[model samples]
Target: MSDGTLRLLLPRFLRRFPADLAAIVLLVLATGVATLAPVISETPLRVVLGLVFALFAPGYAFIAALFPERGPAFDGASASATADEDERSGSNLVERDESADAHTGLTERADPRRAGSIDGIERVALSFGLSIAITPLIGLVLNFTPFGIRLVPIVLSIGGFTLLASAVAALRRQALPVEERFEVPYRAWVGAARAELFEPETRLDAVLNVVLVVSLLLAVSSVGYAVMVPKSGESFSEFYLLTENESGALVADDYPQNFTVGQSQPLTIGIGNHEHEQAEYSVVAELQRVSIRNNSTTVRERQELDRFSRTVPANESANWTHDVTPSMTGERLRLVYLLYRGSPPAEPTIENAYRETHLWVNVSS
Candidate 1:
């Protein structure tokens, strides 16, 4: 092409090239950011980065398309008039020479900016669609694994950012000239997508809507499962007492009421659960003596109960007996019972579920 024709076309070509290049570059960068989302985010930072990339990259791409340089294409006479005017006004000849050079490519070919603008729009649309699809799948995977719960916040943050960025970019693009603005087609595509993928007449509030619905469903299901499942095999409300006497009673004063008595009394403790689910439990039992020497006080004496360490099934109970003896006289005896709704204690120790009952007897002073 002649120098004059080249100068005329150069401004438009230079303006269009950056827009096309930026669109392609932005899409590539956005994809890379998404791919690294899982790796980079130990917490919400991953989502933040993803969102930043997702919004800004495409937006800048659209901006690049919209702001292409448009230079004035002066005709021969106007160009000469400008030079003559510059000379008369004492402006340097350099200005005339540069203007002449600037108009060199006026007639080289038809504008290629149109094709660049169209390509930029298509590129942005494709990037947006791909991101929307991939992000949800990422969320789903994170939800199922042990690490899934942690990813929830990240997903939410990224999703929010994505929506905001897209909206802002679309608005900015809309303000540009029709040929320069890629956002119009993008918004149209988003509208069509909403109709095709979401409920009719419902607002297509992108990430927020999807995240809220999914989170609510998951929370409800979790609560339902917890309520429907029986928590323990051993019933927390019922306990059994089997005294050395066939009548389930221990004579408080038959032997020494304190440690002095060598005789051991056999007693059994049991717990039952009516629910159909098996439950693991921690069981506790204590033997206490009531005294009235100065005032009434209860003393819990250590007793050997061997059967408190196992899980009981639904409608089932474990019964075991231990021999307990009193060390002093005049002490009124009692047995305490406790049934736990969780795992059995790792070692024998006192727990909180015990119930207490007394057995009275006459003691010789």
Candidate 2:
């Protein structure tokens, strides 16, 4: 491809600005990491990158767009002009002390407004604040949309906003004069940091710097560990039986109380997987003939009706309809469902099953 075509293909904001390019790259990385984190590695890289992207990137880009020109504190050109004028005035005052009028005129002519505009510190604080405010607003808007506030929607919306804001910031910066544009002093910061750590004036100073660095690293490690490897909650699964109502909705109340021999009756069995992983379940339906003496019940005989197996995802529910036909006629027959996490043993009983539910019904021939 031609050089111009390649340049044209790239974003306009990224063409000439290193800061914008870096911001765009970081945003893309964060988005990709977050979107693919579940499918990719189990490392805490996603949390780290996602936190930065969610908390800081959007606000910083927005602030940059709003204030493309260098802040008052870093307006070197304006500071230089004022410094030059002061120097000239001081020299004039030194040379012409005999003339009170000349000295007074120099003092009055000096610029009074020393502060130029918002500085680096304010910009940073504002960026954080704006980001915190903007992100939730984006989420709120997404709640109203068809996509809702899901992972993909949230990531894409925030990332899209950040990208657009960064582009606007870059364009605004480009419009400003070269000297007036706000630029992150990456090289200056690195040089200063290097000097502070490597070229400490005394042994104590060096030792203190090392301690500070270590403390920062420890703090970061602690946070990463906490976020990356969270404690697991109580693992459990929900098992229930449901019956279709007159309105065709599944309800727990309309259970079948009577069954005919060789006649199928519809019953819905549901399994909610809360085990934090995919689980395969085996459900065994049995028609039990039992004898009740006082409060104690003993099974005389049991007939297996149907067997069902299902694999359910974590935090999801699976429902299946089964037709229960009693092979033996009896009064107060126990229609039992035994749910096992894995393959059921040779004899599946209520006590052996991971979950168990039963209904009392009478069978007629």
Candidate 3:
């Protein structure tokens, strides 16, 4: 916290500047973008960015931490060449009587398990595979927690894991010698890609490069267009009725079977809007006297009880309580609810209602 403490820590922090700082910075940026983008606006950019971050970054950081040493790069074709190069390099060292003993001592000091260490290509491939494996495992673990696999918990868990792994990787890399640390030579890769794309040798190669660039551009444009302008799906609404349980939770059970005239019963009405836009809805509650003969029912009389309206946004729901008071006494009376998209007609019948629900009850005077 003090100036002297800050000065002492600053040098140590910078003493071994991380070679993979760009990757860590990207992971942090992606986490922030995924977290804030949806709150700011609904866009597919966040989905794409978040998908890449979730499917790659965490595993890559974990792999980096596990393998901080740059493994030997040798293939079948280059084995002989690498051996000859090593022989030539060894010829320059000073000759001494203890050279054999020194070689044996060095070999004994080296870790034999490191002989199976992986190179950059294997690390990258394993990073992607392990990410796919690890992400679902994290979700599975979260399913049992209080969070129950929600967005905020998932993001925090993954983001925190990635950051911790990146820190561990940095520390591990710093512990190794500078030349032995595993680092991504992104600058060199960029330079090589630029040269391959723009600085071709022959006319044929230049023409091929141009074609490749155009193809890449077209592919990117197509994917971006699809993501930005997606087609709308089916639009509909849901209407349901519920009653309060002993736990104060709304459930579709325990309806009042018998109701006295002028007495009130409590019930809940719920609506879910998936219309892809804000919607204004009207609900009409009524009690009807019906005569049933040979399983054919006919409404003899209808009495309107209550009317309610709600304005709900897309992909949202609304719930409200309504009291049902019967003024007419009858046996097996139908307590009906009619839902309309807008204002209901003078006669809101079941045939014309957008949605309808009813419960048969007995009313006594």
Candidate 4:
């Protein structure tokens, strides 16, 4: 950009507070992470980042919605009294300077406290509290929608709502004149804080001193633990079934959707163990009527079609080439491969599953 453009742009952007800029970046990043799933394939990273966005972004926006203007002083009687006192002092300082000076009557600066709207500390704390309270409600609402609280939908929806709230806040703030703008009195607040730190005047001061010390220690310990703690390499398992077709050899899962009752279907079941240890596994294949109602799956007439067992080591894989056939035909039937860590049970459910996958088949009468 040209020098003229830079000069024009700097002041406008600089007027935005650090928190506001942070909110903007977070909102954009949240949406980006949700939309670009392939680019950020690491599930853990996505989950952590998503959590950060949820905890901070909406809360920050909610704070903005409530307190659009940020300035030196807070509202209420104490703040009003402080403002009046500061204004008087500034006036007196100006008067004395003007009378003493030969020229340029305005020698002393105006009081910074008069420019503020709320307590910065209180605003920050309140925002965090509100975010925690509001996030679950937002999730509840998302549950009813088609998205159903998945990564992409939740992130995008929350990010959009947060941005909208922030925009409303900025608009409300802009309604006021620039001179009367409510803003955090950064310099005055910092100076007062530092001065109080050096000379404690109240009992609260002593308590705060202890709190700060403890907080510092905790912060350091948390960082050290994160750095030194041993990581258990990824523990997981993968299972799938495959069958051949006339087109070529094919994965039954990805290709064939139709099946026949009492017709022996030649299929290969494969399991890859990344459980990071030697373990025994059980596979209970079932033909059941699976129906989803009100976000819950209802299984009925579960017929155990096949059962298999194997003990596999870490990073090892096992495969079984066998035939599986359904003895019953019904609408909305599923050929479910329920994989468990131990011996096969009389009945199988996902709750005790180490890994599970399914094949939806159209069983013709």
Candidate number of the best TM-score: 3
Candidate 1 per-residue lDDT over residues 205-227, each given as its tens digit: 65656877799999978866654
Q: Flag clash pairs in model 2.
A: 72-117
RMSD of each: 22.2, 6.3, 6.0, 11.5
- Tell me the tens digit of each residue's lDDT in model 2 across 35-74: 5777653566676777778888889888888888777665
Report, for every candidate in turn, its global Cα lDDT versus the true structure. Answer: 0.49, 0.82, 0.81, 0.69
Worst 10 residues of 2 by lDDT: 107-116
**Native-vs-model 1 lDDT?**
0.49
Q: Rank the candidates by TM-score, best first.
A: 3, 2, 4, 1
lDDT (tens digit, per residue) of candidate 3 on 319-350: 99999999989899999999999899998989
lDDT of 4 by residue, 21-93 (tens): 3456565576566556776643445544555677867887778776666445344433566547768866554
Clashes of each: 29, 1, 0, 9
**What is the overall TM-score of model 4 with all chains considered together?**
0.49
User: TM-score for every candidate vs. truth?
Assistant: 0.26, 0.68, 0.75, 0.49
- Cα displacement (angstroms), candidate 3, residue 234, comes to 1.4
Best by lDDT: 2
Worst 10 residues of 1 by lDDT: 69-78
Q: Which residue pairs overlap in candidate 4's backbone?
A: 70-182, 70-183, 70-184, 71-116, 71-182, 71-183, 71-184, 72-116, 73-116
Question: Which segments of model 3 are wrong by more than 4 Å?
Answer: 1-39, 71-113, 243-264, 292-297
